[model samples]
Target: MAQLSDDCFAFGGDLMPVHAALDLLRSRVAPVTAAETVPLADALGRVLAEDVVAPFDVPPHDNSAVDGYAVFFDDLQADGETVLPVTGRVAAGHLLGREGRRGEAVRIFTGAPMPAGFDTVLMQEDCRPIKDANDGDSVAIPAGIKRGANRRKAGEDVTRGSVVLATGRRLRPEDVGLAASLGRKELSVRRPLRAAVFSTGDEVREPGQELPQGCIYDANRFALIAALRQLGCAVTDLGILPDRLEAITEALERAAAEHDVLITSGGMSTGEEDHVKAAVEALGALHFWRLAIKPGRPVALGQVRDAVFVGLPGNPVAVMVTFLRIARPILLRLMGAEESEPRLFPVKAAFAYKKKAGRREYVRARLARGEDGALTAVKHPRDGAGVLSSLVESDGLVELPEDLSRLEPGMTVEFLPLSEVR
Candidate 1:
């Protein structure tokens, strides 16, 4: 376990910016568990543990691209129709040997192996039967067809001994299909991170329960759990904990002993009954950093024994934003994942917006094609962190930099697709 400085534990001030908070969290945490072998069918979304090299060519041999006639290119005379006996036929999964002599042709179907001694393929439409012509039991091949024009060369798709997939890549359906093409039934992948999630505050109730006055159902837990699952984590739900120090501490202790990381919402701010922060410090150490971002300003990060602690804000929208901007990266790193920057696309803003300088803000926006055939982002009507509905209606978030205070309509801004972040 890594220790934090006393200054890092300070709370209740100007929060660190989102980027700065991420840097600190990543710097202190390391991967908890590693290496596991999983069947290719079950490996989707898992991080690769090693590089995959192709042991054989993709197509494996020269084959016909279409149902056509495989012929010797030199046997055809210039502008003169020549008849050749179709001695053999080749279909997919069947091969014809090198028994064909000079001036011969073989009837071949699509995906069939090209017979030996044949260098070119003429389409079936281009050739006519000998019975209709002056020749007997033979076909007429036209001139001007290049040699080997329609024959698929061996290893054209993937060469032997070539590195097909690199280590640390998250396996997608296409990647799995590619691996299957190379005859791999299993893959080495990193073990999924075990995440324990909970919510704190007696005012938080389960959805089915009757809501007392001044109480709300806990939505952050579901959001956190879903986000963790999206990142390929095995999640353990700890439910909601009261504001009591003992109950919170007991949950933290159990979680630290079992999970790679422990996460919670609420009870982190500097207010009465905020026992999460205090309990975390008493159990191990708690570091609260101020993020210079709108909607999600205060984020608590620390270590509890062996488990990394991530305390998200109580607001539903804030929980989602902070989880994506802060915890997602650290979780990836802890899973031994290779770091790749989020894909950001440049888009023009459709409306004007105002914000203070020195604080970065992510605005939920719907993207549309402008009249100029370019992508334009229109800001959502609501910017409050509690407005979870905004995220449901938007495609992604438009990033406003820390130095810029105002954005005018038609101004260029960076758009980060939510799909890319997950």
Candidate 2:
């Protein structure tokens, strides 16, 4: 398992701003996972461990960009059509056997290498072909065609000895294709982060089990496990731990020994039955970071020995939001990914909202297209933090910044799509 070098991410403030918390995380966290080599077929979504350099030019030779006739540009007539004999033919893979003289034309197809001494191409549609008794085959070239118009120069896409992909970048499908184009079979990448997820609270029960009057099915654990898996983490489900100090402590100790990070939901607040805080404090360091954000105000971060620990809120919606916005970045950094923020798009608001000026808020909303083909964000009817169904009904969240106190309709606001993070 990967481990932290030191435990230095503790904030003493009662409430911290969202940006300040993210900035602190970026400065304090470092990648803990080791590097490994994997084939190109299995490289997608993995963080690159080293830079990839191009060995040679992308298209090793100058080639024709279209099916046409190749010839010397100076041979064409300046005033009218010029007829030249079609002395040779070339296709995608085949090349002309020998160099040609100035007055000769070669029938060439797209991606065919340009023959020696040839500097121009005329499209087949613009040139007329003729057959005669004296001349075997010839094409009538238009005088106004530009010189070198249909030729593709070598190294136009990529140059030799240039860095094509940098370290700490998460490989995408196009990145893999580029590596294949460079004739690379495998890539060096960071190993996936090992994570263990569980839920606490005596009122929580498994989905298939019978629930008592005050008990509810465990949704946070399953949700967290799925989210962690989506982020390419090797997630182990520790099940639901009862709200007992000793039981929680023992389970956490065993899990911390095997995993890089331990994630738990609920039992983070200062309540009588919340034994998670006490248990984590006994086994490791627990720092409660009271964020000024709604729904996920109570979050804990610390370490057990060498493994990192994260305690999130109990509500399902808060669990998803906090995980996506906060814990996701931290885990990504530990997995060797760059500290980058998710892209937020601007869209017109279709609802009015009032919020505290100093706290950041994310409102669940869906987009609707007007008759003019403009997208407008429509806020969800339900606003409760426990309303998990609202997240399902909406497409993403309308991010209200700390300075904004009121949101009116038709105003442009930054929107964070769930697809961007999840």
Candidate 3:
């Protein structure tokens, strides 16, 4: 286990641009988790700590790409058909017993290693089995086939001594498969980040508990927990804490000593009942990063003792947006993973919209394919930060850049698909 510096998130700014805030996080944050080796089955979603080198070339030998007859290209007639004796046969994992001579075809199947003196293959369908003058096995081949056709060269997919997987990569299924291809039974990866998540507010209550007169069920805590798990963190559900400075401070101090991160929604706003900010400031340092982004503007980044503290807005939509765009990058860096921002794709806008200049906005939108097969983004009807249903009904967000103040129909926009974050 490792710990972050006390002043890692001490940078101060007001109404910082989204890019500037991200740049700060990237510059300040580093991995705090230790490395350990795990079996390939348990390595998925874990951050790789070592670079993997290919010990040998993929395929290991020149093989046929399809079931066909392997022969020297020169053996075929230039403009007509030529008959040749079928001397031997080869299948996957098998090789020709003897060297093949020119003007002879050898039966070969897909993945079968090509024999010596064979450079081209003709599909079995194109060649006709016929009888030669000796009445032995023979085949008729056609012309116009190129040299070295249907032959997969050694190292075609991966070369020996090449770095197949790099350090700090979050292991995906394909990454695991590549390691298996290299005969690796286990991989060295960074341990999962231990995280504690909670929500605060006197008006919030548990879902299963009896409904109070003017209270809403806690949703932010559950949502944050799910998001943290999706990022491969081992989350501790700290439950809901009332708006009391003593209780919040006690929980934060205890959790920070055991976890790598402490996440909470609500009680971040500056109000009389918002004791979270005061409690965090008492135990460690706290900084409010007022980003110039729509829906999610007031993001709190700081440290609770050695553990990183993330205070997100109470609104459901804002919590998700800030987590995806802001906190996600910070958490990934702390997990020893490389920067992997979700990719945004360009699509034509199906609705017109406008926003203030110099502020980035992410509009919830669904994608629709037009008759011409082009994708168009349809904005959701609701744009409130508290509208959790809007996020559920939408596919992803239509990102409006800081310089773009107005948008019209058919205009191109970048879309961040929800799947990318998951």
> Whole-model Cα lDDT per candidate?
0.85, 0.88, 0.89
For candidate 2, the 10 contiguous residues with the lowest summed lDDT are: 4-13
Comparing 2 with 3 on TM-score, the higher-scoring candidate is 3
**Number of the predicted model whose TM-score against the real structure is largest:** 3
- As a whole number from 0 to 100, the lDDT of residue 77 in candidate 1 is 84
- List clash counts for every candidate, in order: 5, 0, 0
- Per-residue lDDT of candidate 3, residues 243-338 (tens digit): 899999999999999999999898876668888888889998865446788888768788999999988888899999999988898899999987
Query: In candidate 1, how many clashes are counted?
Result: 5
The weakest ten consecutive residues by lDDT in model 3 span: 5-14
How would you encode candidate 2's per-residue C-alpha lDDT over 166-241 as one tens digit per residue?
Answer: 9999888999999999999999999999999999999999999998999999989998998898888999999999
Indicate the TM-score of model 1: 0.89
Top-lDDT candidate index = 3
Q: TM-scores of all models?
A: 0.89, 0.91, 0.93
